[model samples]
Target: MSETKQSGSPELQWVRILDLDELPEGRVQTVTAGTTSLAITHYQGKYTALDNRCPHQGGPLGEGSIENGWLRCPWHGWDFCPHTGKPPGGYDDGVPTFPVETREDGIYVGLEAKPPRIRTVSDVMVETMTQWGVTHVFGMVGHSNLGFADAMREAERAGKLTFIGIRHEGAAAFAASAYAKLTGRPAACFAIAGPGATNLLTGLWDAKVDRAPILALTGQVDTQVLGPGAFQEVDLATAFNGVAEWSQTVLPSSRHAELMSLALKNAMIKRDVAHLILPNEVQEMPAEGKPATTPEGRVTPMEITPPAASVEAMLKLLRTSKRPVIVVGHGARFHMAPIVQLAEQLNAPVVTTFKAKGQISDHHPLGCGVLGRSGTPIASWFMNESDLLLVFGASFSNHTGITPKKPIIQVDYDAMALGKFHKVAVPVWGEIGITANLIRNELGAIDTVDQRPEVRARWAIWREEKLRREKDDRGRGINSASVFAAMNRVIPENAVIAVDVGNNTYSFGRYFECTRQSVLMSGYLGSIGFGYPAAIGAHCAAPDRPTICVSGDGGFGQYLGELTTAVKYGMNITHVLLNNNELGKISKEQRADELEVWQTSLHNPSFARYAENCGALGVEVTEKARLDECLERALAHEGPALVEVRADALLV
Candidate 1:
């Protein structure tokens, strides 16, 4: 490590090292100044520096990985700001960050004290956020959180952070969720008490399900009026218990930075949302101590230790079973090499859950596509015939593999997920340990049952046959199959696809063949309105790649306001609305259940017109002949665009 800056000013004295070109993208390099160490990262042609230690347990920051603008500590995946050394959400204390100056020859870091002012609680709140790397806040304003909302406005004007207002609390939560997922950090959201908190539940659940970090701040009644059945005074602590990883009520006139710090640390450490119930009185409180700075040092990486006996048992079982099958999930995604090696070692067919669709390419000889109700017939057949099943890194949700009479070996990071929905004969927990054990230990080789060679060949033939059939399945008029094929042709190979829940989702699953895996869906949650915001998130995550959202008219209407968010961020996602003039899935389900389908039918708006109103390029395709042109136009547009494809009311 080298130092460059030499100054006598205690606040401004710092040092510089390596030229800007030396820092690699998505990787952080450590530099030292006196006894202080810092992690420096370069993103989108900008250099940012933070104390090398995490405030939560002093994890090493240099070891953390950089994705988007957030730096995730490698040890426990705690996210922090490389710009101001502030943790996501609000933290009581932030890392000590120095001013960064870049020149043609080298980069310099300077330590400087901020000018003091008579700051309000809201002022401190915004100031704390400036230390963190967040540039925007996605939320809905209400009476309870009005002060915080006003503070956000001030922050926006001061060039500290931007505030994006949403239509509903649910939408705000969902938008924040998407933002966090895209940026790989905890995005903040504000909601009022009572109904506001309740409305945010669904989106919060979605975030928890997807493992996205978010910060939810809701206003509460003053502490002095507690248990008095005061208006809007619900037990916020109990109300948000199950919805968030950590929830707490801020006391009246309490130290704002300290409480905010606690919330941020909890969210970062737990890798989940931290809900802070701020009382009206607390929003105007004054600070007591000098605001804390970001910590310094390297984060320790997590290690998974394997159980020796369990590994040996699993290998022995794999060797004994002639027709074994491996089901890969998201856990397998993190260790792609190990998974590929295991698949090759056993010569077993590999099938993925919907979320893990492209863990291994479908073109691989032993690779089978998704396995579920929407999976390919060949994958279903493989599952039905397998003698031993090895499932990795995914919960055996009800929507996944239904059930197999054969023995199951489940490998996952969460023990609760094991044997929750299905029975598991051998369950191994932890990512690295299970994988390492399998690789190191070799059991006896069992005789290969070559009886299914012809069967396997037939399945391969069938896969190709299905693709051809899909291509030729376009009917006389506009239909789901034709729309999918058109979309497949128009979307770039690297595009990320977000499919909304409904009958349209089923059609998308059947028709869309993702060339490379960047597709996202609600998966087990099956939540409505997931498509649009998720597409925005995907675009944020990989701005270089285009993102397309396929949704039904009903699903699109739920979060249509997100168009403003896309425009604000200058994202270039293409929104495709499958206009069928009805809730297609619910209509089918009602008919099946012999119930009256009253509200299932919908009179949808002209999505093209709606998109235009939101300041994005819009196109309407009522006929199949115009789809290719419309899709092309929508995709080529500079910013967000919408393409509405009108189709029949029913799929049959």
Candidate 2:
């Protein structure tokens, strides 16, 4: 029997614990009564309920075995009266009781109403995160991070942030890194103390190497149990030593707001990972009325103009040169407009580093394609012919293969990146857009070579070569040229493409002609399995734009489970999976090194069927003729969709 509160008895709440048939008869089960856990016992064909904890040692009584007409505690084998929860004969200790009733639809448990939420340390830190424009969070919630997860829940409910629960911590980190890469803002990746924290290393390394800002929030064991090798405890600070620019532990004595401020500031200024450790004990501590921190005045404008001396030298070089070329990289993505305008003014052919493939459209009059191993002949021809190279934000990485022999002017915001590998003719320490604008404003019309006609001729020659390659089929698999040709026509102009490493990525660089699209990649790290996870991140960063993932079968297998992540969020991503059934890049490299292609083959499954199983639209294309039609259909679908294009392993 239960009594209803007569309008004043501590405002009550009705909570449905379980469906009527959820629990088997004569079984004891635990249910929540408001925030209090209750031991609901049903034995001898009658329902009885009490505290779920054993009074003796706080062992869970619901988990105890029912033996000889009494419930036996599993921890100490202590017995209690099954019906009234009274102890066996003269023992006063027993579980407390609460009123419960069986409704037609479900079981309901009654207890005092829950109290209003109290501000916690995690709340303060999370509030600081929201205040700093951390809109997207990707990670897995585990045992040690419960208190902090609850705070995130509250924030999500309040519409202050978005939390995506991922299957693997690695995917979470990659998603966060990709978000940062696309938006130039920090996104958080959460994990538990030990293995979870370590799983983030690869993706975090991607962010660190590429100079993208990322935040890591990790949970730890209780403060008291930190030392002496407690479960899930590792030296996280030392573990993240190389990756994070700022790593700190949140303690009860810590100035919660200030801790967050430092972490965020370091992440923004250095474009590095910032980490905060939350001890299990400290995460739930009451905030004591402290306010959260924000990014107001913490960030300064990053538009540094080139020094006058460097500008004059660069102008002199450009003016004297017969052929001038502009080479932009991934770091110049945000400031591409002015760079393109400068190219137009100079009539200079614009060739991009592989990472900066889409910054300059292939359709532009002065735009050449990617330059390097994954590059086109057009870019190579121009770079080889140019007398002066105006490099903006292009890291002199070996992959891009920028020639040090050429007379070059390199511009970057980071002074350390200037002449990082070798001496340049002019190392301008300034923001790329600002420097471009400054040079454009300062320069007068000079007699310089107009490379526009040559640019068009080179593009025409390359397109013919690409078309010829598209038709060279051994009947072993579909050629990559055909695949990209189809995608170039069908995919949206405003699409954000996330490309993975391997032959697929190389082909994308060489064959795909971009027009008004943005490309995201694991640039410096060159990590595989970055495509799909990065798609999730890019979609979150720009929900209005169409998100696409381009990956080979070898790379996609690394994080195939992320398809479910895309499905769960209803991300409108069209994944173009190149299924070659082998690591074609490795095989080709083996051939080049005069070594046997050992262990380069991969066993595969039908990825399209897998996508269908995950509640996404899936289409498999074995015929070269189906590329355009199939991709068009998948891209038209509003949600997550995948098209597995069977390609020849040798064709790429």
Candidate 3:
């Protein structure tokens, strides 16, 4: 294959590939014209193409997929667009983009030379991204990304876009995910080759499960020395395959626009991950084309409508049933007003999963509080006693649904999730928002009954019983309730709380209340080390907001290195270490099985000392009396801070 540079010509040129009908939705195919390899993707009634190699490490871009408008590399999960070759969310470097047009018979990609003096790949990428309305890029600096990082710095100085430096590569990915989720737009992150790419996998997995649109860029070894065991060489494509929706390696400079465009399209449209593997050597290589335009920021319209059969069936059941209960989950979080209205109309008590707490307040007249393993006993008792369960926006997993055999009217966005675990008598398929509206509209059609007075009386008794039970259990060491109450008092209402998994998550669930929807957790992945990185991401996502991370001693240590990232970025996030000094859950399980808890016992460093070593504020609280003062000091500090609270492992 020979490389072609742009000549001073205004005419457009093209390379023809497959027929329009040959492309399939949600899948990609590879095509080669002479020496240039191209990836073609068909998605949401559009077609796009990009180069076959990842810029980071020459990972095959032909294997990537297109969702929305972003093309996701199957290798390391980097994202770029096939139309403009720009990375989504204001990335500096762009992949090569070809002009794609579909005729009655076939699809054609233009091979026009971009303008001269494009300067650097990052400049071209930035120009392309600006066209897409992406204003921010989240990344960490390392040896492999020196040139691109320099370009990003220049871009930031020029006010072309904003670049937020993160301490760790993983933190960068997590921050990008949070930003994308909150804004409903694509976000980008970059990292050096080898270790940096490996470190980012944890955050990438979370994004994949949560369905966030993220573009991950990774530096790669020189393409010339690939697979010959060059320095810092590793198969990044294989490393990221499990988590990314698509992955690709950028090839030689001649094909930059094509590959980059593919990646962006995948990340944006699919609301999934796209990995772009860029070779260290090719980043400075010259390419020519007309200045690429940024994609217009367009909101994806919600198309879900309520199923008539399911809605009618559920309404009939609700009207006839005497003892009905409503169980809300994370799905209901976005439909708070309608959910509350529905609860009021039915005159029924409401219980939420831990993730869905605050969907209704604890003080609501018929609120039963959270319903789960760690939920209020009264809530659980009511769920068990109810004849029909009106499940909304929740999967009714084993963790949330203890009474699966009971008759359930499930409302969900995905119909397949309905009746998968529980006995769902009616399955309503619709967006939670729309379904809530439909239910509200139908409320007036049903016969009216003044059941609120009776329901309120029963709830009062239940609430008192729950308070008594919690009071009796207060003496238990490491009781989650005491920790929650203390935390509730100390943590400010404007704070952003990030919780890790394990018994610590369950414990935190007992007392963590959010006045607003600022709480973040790994509900889908349930990964142990998510808290620390997630906190870093949350802090980066909302710099003005006070962020707090609560993690078990075990979960905290898993991503302890992220503290250094926090320090480096000067993020103001308070990290609360629940120092049980052991893998409490595993230890408890082992003891129950009559096995010795050997490796579960961890020798932890003094957390305060570790935080101090990382150049962050540190405090230790052994007694409950010192907690308030310790937390106040930590929050008052300017940068990242850590507060380690020592507790008995047996309580978990």
Best by lDDT: 2
- Candidate 3: C-alpha lDDT: 0.73
The sequence of per-residue lDDT tens digits that candidate 2 reaches over residues 442-485 is 77786678888898898889988988998988988799999999
**Candidate achieving the largest TM-score:** 2
Worst 10 residues of 2 by lDDT: 1-10
> What is the full ranking by lDDT, best candidate first?
2, 3, 1
- When 1 and 2 are scored with lDDT, the better candidate is 2
| Count of clashes, each model | 16, 3, 75
Badly placed stretches (over 4 Å) of model 3 are: 1-118, 126-138, 159-164, 178-186, 252-265, 287-289, 293-300, 445-479
Task: For residues 433-460, write the lDDT of model 1, one tens digit per residue.
Answer: 4464465345434565542463467566
Question: Per-prediction RMSD in angstroms?
Answer: 17.0, 3.1, 17.0
Q: Candidate 1 at 4: error in angstroms?
A: 53
TM-score of 2: 0.94
How displaced is residue 209 in candidate 1, in Å? 3.4
Using all chains and alpha carbons, the TM-scores for the candidates as numbered come to 0.72, 0.94, 0.73
TM-score quality measure for candidate 1:
0.72
Q: What is the lDDT of residue 399 in candidate 2?
A: 86
